[model samples]
Target: MVAKGKVGILTTNYYNPDGNRIIYGGAERYGLELTKLLLELEYEVAWWQVGTGWQKEMLPGVPLYSIPETGDNFQTCPRLNQSFYEQAVQVDFAIYFVTFLAYPQVLEKSISISHGIFWDYPSFDAVIPTEELRRERLRRLWLAFNGPRKIVSVDTATIQWATTTWPGLWHKFEYIPNFVDLNLFSPSEQERKDGKIRVLFPRRLTSVRGINEAARAAEILTKKYDNLEFHFVGRAHDDNLEKEMVRWSAKHPNIYYYWKAPQDMPHVYQNVDIVLIPSKSTEGTSLSCLEAMAAGCAVITSYVGGLPNLIIDDYNGLLIRPTAANLTAAIEELAFNHDLRKRLGQKAREVAANFGLEKWKRSWAKVIGEVFK
Candidate 1:
């Protein structure tokens, strides 16, 4: 097939700019799938992201470039976007992997993505310390919103937030939830030989992801229940955080901490009996939650951001406020009730079928076709 046209994509970071290690996270996975979709649609693709001005290959032929521009107090990098816009002049279209990256100026044929609201937490107060700073940030975001032809929001909470913040811009958004590869994350047919109830926390070691709550719950529940085991299966932002988790896990019985590549996650998901997505804030319809549901694991997640979109309390999965006590109780209840576990897992898999990879591709293709044509 003849290539349609070249598309330049800009992001914050696809990988560590100084090294070859790829950042394994939900947003990175979304970017990968989006790039693959563009490739499947016969568009030549190149990527730009914040780094030490190095160049690498994202795939076989797709080039990934880096820019040295740094963000300011608002975390908006206009210089990076401007750099991308200027350097990608030969490209026919553009994609802002992050919404804020399109600020100040953007190409005519471009769109942006919103992973969800990142400013919902209390610590964001330090980022925008004054009213003037807050207003300036809003002004930049407003300009960013106007720059993109359409903003693809991964969850409804983002669209809701945008509309509430700036009421007249409802026409600028498209709702497309995150997706999962059902074939890869399917349930195990065989029963567990060890007869242990395993619970998985498949998220980064961050406070917003409720890692603290999860850790507290793990410490409490593992000590209380002999048959229960807790697994923490994701990386932290720094080596210190990783070391802390490793040391903490080492000190506790029935608690384990390890990280796995995105491709290797299917086996890990399939082996687990339960999944916890205890996000306190700043989330979308998470890939981990969807993959867990697809793997037929009974999921317990917090009612924050887009998590509620995936789970219904006592229906497909358990949705609750993210607290150490609440998580411990949920795990305890699931551990004691085998029938509830089986039912929730079965329903979760059934609900997860609606967000399959093919459907996601078709939805994205429609939007891309309309914008790029």
Candidate 2:
């Protein structure tokens, strides 16, 4: 069925479309894909970013719009002064990246998507928060999510967290995991040759994701074995982290950085033997993990968060503590043994086959379509 009204997606960061293609992490990917799905279903789609950044172009027929930044960028939340609240505003429904950024009563129908907890996982910090800030965040979260709209969590961890912490709001939340196109992400001919192995850090170059630590680990390993090369794909959300990555690449000939989107990550993953996801914080479910798995890369990730749920510690993939020593060891362990890497990757693909785009689309359509009813 064709959607009857325009749908707007509000995001925390001003997403640059033509620049990186897949700009933001999992949430942006979800929002972007959902926009495509809506357009396919004949809905008028409006892509709303908090500010007008580098995005001058949009996906063919979809027009992009910006919300006036309310002059408030408190930690991880974007507070817009006015959004979807004018006589000219034609969007009947809006899908928010997270509940905190949702415009109060701005759309005829509003659906909150719980991708990841921004406060819990700040783009800048690799450290713990102050108690005062934590309390303030909690207050804002209650103000945001303690409303009537249907909320969609990207994974089960989010539902469990919300139910335990927020209690009464459990009835409103829905679990919808991240997905990958199986056809788009699969194995390719091994790119490793001449005793050289490629290890890829696919997440944004953020300290929280352990880019610095990973770089240090890679540098140390390169000193021991010259054929060990490291490649980082995707741009940084944090400037310092980006600079650090560039500097590290300069310092270590074995480490390399791609400032822009490679655009085709499946090919990128397939070309590499290892995929690293050393996140300091939790995710509902990691899209990086799922995608890399589908591409048949030997997956190595932190034991924290939903990673343990996806990886079985050398069963399907390898899981380690998010530390330089641990991550370095995991990479080295997989690199030295080709058979283990192949076995883990094959099993990883088998596991990832369950999370395809078709399943995700049907579930998301049902949840979003429920809003109109």
Candidate 3:
């Protein structure tokens, strides 16, 4: 067992120069929150950034280091060389935010916290859906084979997915739900002025996330409830899918599209009546759903991946199949009944409390304590 001492976090930094304080992405936000939790537990913490162009100004009071971007051959990269190993050796343990298992030297004393599996899943944006990409993906599997001393997943479904995809790795697995800052996403007492029922969809406009399905649902729902408004927030120029969404928005006035500005999320959630997550791909316990629940917004999502575990249908929130008809039905049900929305929102808040900052701190402390013991 590794001795208990200061812990180092190896993660990608998300400091943008646009003056946004809060990072919206799940993995980046998770790493930051984990660092805060470790600090609260009285464990000295340090950050090792793997990529370049990260702003240091936002990361005040935290000791930081940067790793130069390695080309295709990451083995020869200085970031993966002996110097990097020597620097990380100072810490008692290292927690990798994602799968960087190609460098086994670092994995010797490291724990892996993965958002998703590295090999089995195919990139949704890749143009070549051929055998070449499949073989390349197979080659990447070797990196994960080296793996980490300990593996942490965000939810039971994630753990199960990982184990099912790769057998004989269950013994090293542990479940630790994602933590969120409840203070930032609190319920507002101010009445929503807009007569239209506002629905927020905060996801990348891509096929994997089922954004097309969301748009289709909006098209169907608009026929019945003309006052309904659908707002999508994410990268606008990243893909052609977003361009298609923009075109759809132009045709329909009720549909709105906003480029994701990190600081504006809390305000966005505050104004919306419900949050929708209609992902068709594998999800690693969505942070967007958790944030919406914390903000006292009724969540309507598909019963896929870790979503079902986070949201209990008709209890904390509503879970529907990944279909336009079902999604439209769920939205219609929530929009007509104000009391049901209030009850679901209250239950969601209660569930989110379990994943508060303090709870995560305690969980990390216990894990570190056990590892040292």
Best by TM-score: 1
The residue-by-residue lDDT of candidate 3 on 97-144, one tens digit each, is 665433444535567676753232355335336687655554454354
lDDT at position 263, candidate 2: 64
**What C-alpha root-mean-square deviation, in Å, does candidate 3 show against the real structure?**
5.0
Question: Which lDDT tens digits does candidate 1 get at residues 239-335?
Answer: 8999999999999989999998788999998888999999998999999999999999999998888887889999999998888999989999998
TM-score to true structure, per model: 0.97, 0.87, 0.77
Lowest summed-lDDT stretch of 10 residues in model 3? 72-81
Q: What is the lDDT of residue 278 in candidate 3?
A: 77
Global lDDT of each candidate: 0.91, 0.74, 0.70
> How does residue 295 of candidate 1 score in lDDT?
94
Question: Residue-wise lDDT of candidate 2 within 281-323, one digit each (tens)?
Answer: 7465788899999999999897655666678888889887778
* Candidate 3, residue 296: how far the Cα is off, in Å: 2.6
Clashing pairs in 3: none
RMSD of each: 1.2, 3.4, 5.0
For candidate 3, what is the total of clashing residue pairs? 0
User: Candidate 1: where is the Cα deviation over 4 Å?
Assistant: none
Total backbone collisions for each predicted model: 0, 0, 0
